[model samples]
Target chain A: MARHLQDTIYKYVTMCLSGVALALIFIIIGVLIDSSYPALVVYGSKFFTSITWNAELTGSICYTSGIAHMCGATFGVLVYLTGTLLSSGIALLIGAPAAVGLAIVLAEIAPRRLASPISFVMELMAGIPSVIYGFWGILVLVPYLKSTLEVGLSHSLSSVPIFSGAVFSAGLLASGLILALMITPIIASISRDAMRQTPEGLKEAGRALGLTDWEITYKVVLPYARTSIIGSIALGLGRALGETMAVALVCGGASNFLPKTFFYPINTMAAFIVFQLDAAFTDPSGMSISVLAEMALLLMAITMIVNVVARLLVRRGFVSRPENLIQV
Target chain B: MEPDREPTNSVQLQDSFSFEGPVRPRNYTRRKALNLFVKGLLIVAAVLVLYPVVDILYLFAYKGLQVISISRLIETTAGAASFNPHAAGGLANAILGTLFIVGLSSMIAVPLGVFGGVYLAEFSNDNRFSSIVRFFADVLAGVPSIILGYVGFLVLVLRFNLGYSALGAAIVLSVLMFPYTVRATELALKRVPNGIKEGALALGSSKTTIINRLSLKFALPGILTGILLSLSISVGETAPLLYTAGFSDYINWTACCHTQIGYLTYVVFTFYTIPTTNAIDLSYLATFLLILIVLVINIVARVGLRRLSRDLESRI
Candidate 1:
């Protein structure tokens, strides 16, 4: 009877401990919504549309629908939203192709001895802290871009408005490139695993049909791993979107306006929250912090959607076991 | 000479030869060229992808080695307001504080995560509750660290009135570390084959006894890997700890609440922007230390995983 009771108690205890995850998610969402209530009520739908983000620190206090705020303090996330999307989009454009190519090389072209070491190196890259990336970005990439890429682009593509601009040390271009570097290892490793899983019989048939090695890879291997490759890219995209410190350091911290060119300053949603939070604490009306909470809410919702999509696609592909899913 | 008499036979021969001659060589050559070009591109892509990692490491080593020394490891950070190069100090405070905070967080998260994983792998069988927990754990993993920081600041620092304490930072770090541990533990436990359990059951051993004696022992290395990975993550994290932990120049060992703590990541983030040569050098040193620590942890984890898998193979 004692043993029976012990077994039952152990099961219940483990179950309750596991529920911590569920409780955590609920608490996070709950706190965000509860904190952002004032902003949500006041800003309504205009939060997405407006471009102004004045905290109105010096202005007199006012009330909008029972939420008190400094007068003329209008918050809008359009600039941040644009920055997040555009920077991540640029990262995807540059990273996805390079990652696919790297995957192909690792899976099809390189020998096992060579591939394993290179994959290890890439995993190390993934494990490197974000702050280090940001540190490297600020000290190295920003200056390098300013001196070379920006100057070269402006000179060569003078006719194209987006490519032609006064060069800055940090901006959309720097952030995008940094994000690309950050996401490449993630996309490459996952895609390489997926491509490696392609059936040998299919490649053999292609070879028998007089297909070259590259032809076999492109025609047989890539198509077989298509879903997984897409999933990996989406996963990379999710990382790029939420990447904070690196983007924050090199993003130039633009506000109240949208980026005008590739080299123009920008701020992502994730970065903006970090940048604005200290300042948000200054507003006596308490609405500024609430607005920041709303931004967090938006960012969370966006990442959640992307992650869900990525998981579905990955699950539909070769990796059915949950254990096999790569850590992002 | 016989062309006029045999026109139909000649036409048939010409048609058969025509089908084989021109098309095969032209198509084969084009395909071969295309294949070579793509292969070259793939090689280039691989090189490009690898260049940055090497560059970052080289850069850190080049700069960090110049600044790092025994004193740097033993001394505390200088005040943020002090800009004088002469007043610059070492990273002992940050290092110790990181150890304290990450250690505290590990103490809180490891058992919970391990137990949670055990539940998922052993106790539950596709029940609604377990599935819900699993799904939400994935969701929690996906949440941005900055948001976690914001929530941490709001709930722990402000509401709970911990006031930028080590305990607050540890709690936040544990939250960040939790999902990874649970997933890793569950996966490790699941890899334990069921045949052993069945055999033990036939011998009339209780389920709890089998888990405690057999499965836990087998999964120990994997569980350790998970804990190490989480520790590395906690060490590298900056966004979540930014507000919750705040920053300090000296190591405050006794106070868990109402006291700030220094960490390596904060130094890397804040110090470089300062113009002083000493400050920038210290930043590089901090970064180098971070990279070294994370690399060591990852290498240990990888080695552990390999040994565990080999052991499992030999036993099973």
Candidate 2:
């Protein structure tokens, strides 16, 4: 009886302690609301759409910031997002095949000794922080990009809008390339795992049919891992959205009036939040900060939904299917 | 029942890829070229990520090695310059302040984060609390550091009467790290199998004993990994500390409210723009020292984790 009581107490203690995460959320939201109340109540929904943020001209602290001025910031965000998509997409196009090939090389073709180090490198890539990636971008990629883009932009018939300008070192292209390098690990990792989940019997059957090494990778293994590869891309997409320091450092901070040339200066939503929110905190213009919050809320929503879906897909995705491969 | 022994039904995991015929060209040269191109491409990627970390390290060692070696680098503070080559004191105070702030943040955050994760993993079994916690962790992970610092300035530094002490910075960091701790903890805990708990229960051990002695022990290496990752992360964080920690002229010897501790990052940011030659040189040295300190700490912790994991694995 005493043991049972003790057990109940422990469970209660553990369970209650778990509420700490919930408490944190409430606290953060509560504080944001409490601090930003001057703006939230006055503007309400319009606060999100409003753009410009000077407080001196407006009679109230809670001036309705028009979306027109923020167009540059908004455009900055869009350009950065597009940059993210393109780079990440290119990375997938390049990485997925390589990952599938590497999986084949590691699983099907490689000698026993080679697999672990390759696998380790893939994980280590994921572990490298964004700051490190930015450092690399500043040192090597920037100089290379300047020369490379200048040459590409010079010889242009299709250079009408975003592509017309000179390819400066610190614009969308740099951001995209950096983002691509960062997300490659996520895509490669998940895809490699997905391929590994291919049932041994399927590969054996492919070999039995006199399929070459390449044939096994393309025909038998890849199809088996398709759902997982898509799932990995989704996970990588989540990381790309929330990426800070690296993108902020690389993306030119001059908020060009909504993306102009591909090489025009821009900022990501994450970068904008990092760059502006500090000065805004002191005697801050009300609706501007709220709107930033709304953007943050949006970014948070996208990241969470995608990640949860990714987690669900990546973790239990195979379980629903009757025939499974790599149980892990 | 064997773990992977569930009986298969008619449903297949996925469709097999169609290989009706060889539509791909029979050009061996193209295939070889394509493969080589891809290998080079990935190698470039490796270089793209590797070079900057190397550069920052290079700059830190090259320019600052002079100041760092004077042996006074860690001992002095930025007193009014009059000495040869401008001796702007040592990083002793910055080091102490950073340690103090980071330590307090860890002390507050780790227990809360670990418990939240444990609760989600062990108790809830994918209940509402667990789902909410997971979602919050994801969202929190993406919240920008500067915003958190801004938020911290408004809330803790202003409202809480903490007044930008080491405690305030620590609290903000603790909050910043909460999400990672929760995520890492949940992951580590989830990896613990059910059988271990069941066996302990069967042995007449209480649930607390099973949790403390069995489960936590098993989960230690993973928790350590998570904490190490957190520590490494906090080391580079500048913005949150910028707002909450503030600038301490002194070494924060007593960890008091009146004196906010000076951190290496602020000095780097502030000193770089100063008009005086002495201040700029001082800032350069500070940047170098900051990079060195972070690198050393990160590598040492990582090495420690690798050793600990190996030791644990061997014992098991």
Candidate 3:
């Protein structure tokens, strides 16, 4: 009787413990759908396509119960959604190659004694909070970009459409710069692991053939770590896509139009929600709150797909070794 | 220099690639120049990685250090004049609020994360349900922190009427922290040698006894590292706490689920936007404190993981 009782208790406890993981999925879906139901019902698919976000219908009633006012016909997230993609895509473009080079330098080129300390510093960089990055972007990066880089670019690249617009201190470019800096550590660390796992035999074989050190690294090591490097870039992409506070602070909070140029101010979906959420709670219109929730749902779906795909890519050949899993 | 030792398989390829006449005395100077160029690029990359860390530290030290004092550490934001960086008030409430929320969250998350990890690692035998659980855990971890805050706003704040409290904020932070804990603990448990578990089983030990008594003890250091990593993540969070914790000017020692609480990230997010020198200084101070907490946590995690690996190496 005692043994049976103990077995039952153990089974119950473990099952319940594992249930927590499953519960998270349900909660995310439930909250998003339940809170955003009114928008789902009212806007249907137009919420994704329409660009206007005029949620300030002074006397309209919200479909969600218990709200006196709400967004009338013109609510949508097309602009913010585009802003999120534009910044993250540009950030990945700028960050991935630099990160790969840094990873190679740390893993193969730098002397062993110097390499470990640099690796530690990169990890420390990763640990800094997103808000702090935003703060730095505002005070330091923005001014520098405005007074130096943007001015230089405007003068040199004025014929280019993207650089023709009047440069703002904070905008898509600023957001992307901050994101590039933020994601460098994640990409570098993961790719370093990939590089470290390359067989020593191949490197030695290259060396024996009178190949230069750089040539051995380029031809033998990099090709071997290609998939892992791609996986790390994907991992970095996921982080950049979902980054909130830092992007929010630097993206200049402009929600009006899709950004036509890199220097034009824009607002990401995450930033829109963060900037508007406080007013959302107190606003007479419940529609704005639900619309934000719907935006959250969209953001959640995207990040989930990116992360899951990235993990699968990272896990494909390294199934037996769990240590290679990307920490992000 | 010895062409005679060339492998038969590579002789034809080498002949085609090399200069036609007597292997043209391998250009030593060109190889040296290429190597130097590559080394220069590597040095540039290293500098690129180090530049931001130095920038943030230098700026914070110059700006944030000037205004920080004992009062700033201990006094509540209440009763202080707004926009005055030199006000007699401090972030004592925000400090306490952060500690309270993070502490309660760790208490809830650590046990649940550990048990879930054990299930994934020790039990389940890679069954379908456990696989699903693991998949969702990964998915949950990838969900943006702001989205989690929105969820918290809907469920805890609006639906449950929890009223922007530390309890609600902690719950949101736990959800954010949960996957890291699970992954870390699971990885740690996997690190325990299979031989040890088999030895225990042969001695007539129950599976529970082996897991709780033997395996957990062995994996404790890695698990602790994971917990600290999660805590650091929780400490640095801003979005989730935005709507869930709200903000209070004063410390509220009321029920955990009732009072709106202040956090350092909140100050960093809100204060710098204000146009006052004092406000900007306060934001910088809060930013410095936040960076300090995360740096310490990350350092501890790294040291703990290194020690755990060393322990594993010794056992081998």
Candidate 4:
């Protein structure tokens, strides 16, 4: 009887502990919504549509819908929203193809001797901290882009509107490139695992049809792993969207303005929160912080949607090995 | 064979099957060329993907080595007001503070996470509650760290009135780490074979005894790997800690609440753009240290864990 009772107690205790993980998600969402309510009430639709984001820190206090803010303060996240989407979009565009190609090499072409070392390197890359990536962006990538890529693009593509702007050292282009480098390992590693999971029987069937090695991979393995590859890309996109410090350092900290060109300055929602919170703290009305919370809410929602989609797409009855579930 | 059906098209089937002079397919060369081109592209892609890793390591090592010294490892960071080129202090405070915060958070997160994982793997067995827990843990993992930081600032620092304390930072870090640990533990426990449990049960051992004496032991290395991976993550995190931990120049060992703590990543983030060369150098040094620590943790988790798991499997 005592032994049975002990089992019951242990099970209940573990279940309650598990509940903590579930509770955290709700608590985060609730806290964000509760804090951002003031900004939500005041800004309403303009929050999504307008381009203005002046905190008006020195201006007289006023109330909109009983929420206090500086007289001229307005919060519009269109610029930040655009920055986040465009930068991540750029990262996806560059990273996905390279990642797929690298995955193909790792899954199909590379000898076992070569593959392990490369994988270890990729793991190290994934483990490198975001701030270090940001630091590297500041010291190396930004300057290199400014001197070589931006100059070359502006000169060679002078007639193209997006490509032909006054080039800056840090902006959308650099942020996108940095994010690309950061997320490549993630996408490549996941896609490589998925591609490797393509059944041996399927490859044998392709070979029996006299397909070349490359043909076998492209026709059989890639098709087999299509959903998983897409899922991995979505995962990568989710990561790029939420990347903060690296984008913060290299995105040129644009505010109240949209990016005009590839080289134009921009700011992501995640980066904006980090950059703006200091100034937000100074706003006596406390609405500025609420606006930042709203931005965080938006970021959370976007990433969650992407993650949900990834989960759905990646969960198509494939028996995912535990080791393949590398932390994203 | 000759008359299975009427001849399908203009050309007779017999004539189509007649032996050709060489029997070369028209698109063979094209296919081969396409395959070769793609193979080349794949190789190039692999190289391009790998180049940045090398570049980052080389850059950090070349720059960080110049600034890194024994004194820098032992001294506390100097205040910005005392700005000087030659006399800037080290990151001893940040290092100790990082250890303290990560250690404290680990203490809070590990047992809860492990127990949570056990519930999912051993007890709940795909019930609605466990599924909800699993889904939310995944979603939590995907949530942005900066968003976590904002929430941490709002709830812990402001509402709880922890006031930018180490305890606040540790709580936030533990939250960031909780999902990883839970997932890892669940996966590890699930990997334990059911046959052993059945055998133990047939022998009249209780479920609790089997779990305590058998399964958890087998899954120990995996659980440790998870903890180590999360530890590495928390070590390098800057965003959440920026507000919750709040920076300090000196190490405060006694106060866990309402006192700011220093950390390495903050040094890299804030000091890099400072005008003084010393500040920049310190930043590089911090980056170097962070990279070193993170890499070592990752290697141990990935490589060492694999070997240990293999040894355990062999023994079993």
* Tens-digit lDDT string for candidate 1 (B1-316): 3221235544766788544332232367778889899899899989998898889889998888988888778889865336775665889999999999999999899999999998998899858998888778877877888989999988998788888889999999999889888877887787778888889989988878988898887777777777887788789999988879988999788446889999999999988877877777889999999999988988888765667766875787
Best by TM-score: 4
| Top candidate (DockQ) | 4
Q: Could you give the CAPRI-style class of model 3?
A: medium
User: What local distance difference test score does each model get?
Assistant: 0.85, 0.61, 0.81, 0.87
Cα TM-score per model: 0.94, 0.75, 0.92, 0.95
Q: Is candidate 1 or candidate 4 better by DockQ?
A: 4
For the candidates in turn, chain A alone yields TM-scores of: 0.95, 0.77, 0.92, 0.96
DockQ of each: 0.56, 0.20, 0.52, 0.69
Candidate 2 residue lDDT tens string, A134-187:
655665677777777545774563456657755667866677667766666666
Model 3 lDDT tens row, A133-244: 9999988999998999988898899999998868898998999989998889888888887888889999999887777788788899889988888877887888888899
Give the per-residue lDDT digits (tens) of candidate 3, residues B208-276: 888889898888877888788778879989999998999898887553666899888999998877677
Candidate 3 Cα errors over 4 Å, as ranges = A1-8, A62-73, A316-326, B1-36, B81-86, B308-316
lDDT ranking, best first: 4, 1, 3, 2
What is candidate 3's CA lDDT for residue B251? 84
Backbone clash pairs for candidate 1 read: none
True contacts kept of 1: 0.67
Order of quality (TM-score): 4, 1, 3, 2
Looking at candidate 1 chain A, the ten consecutive residues that score lowest on lDDT are A317-326
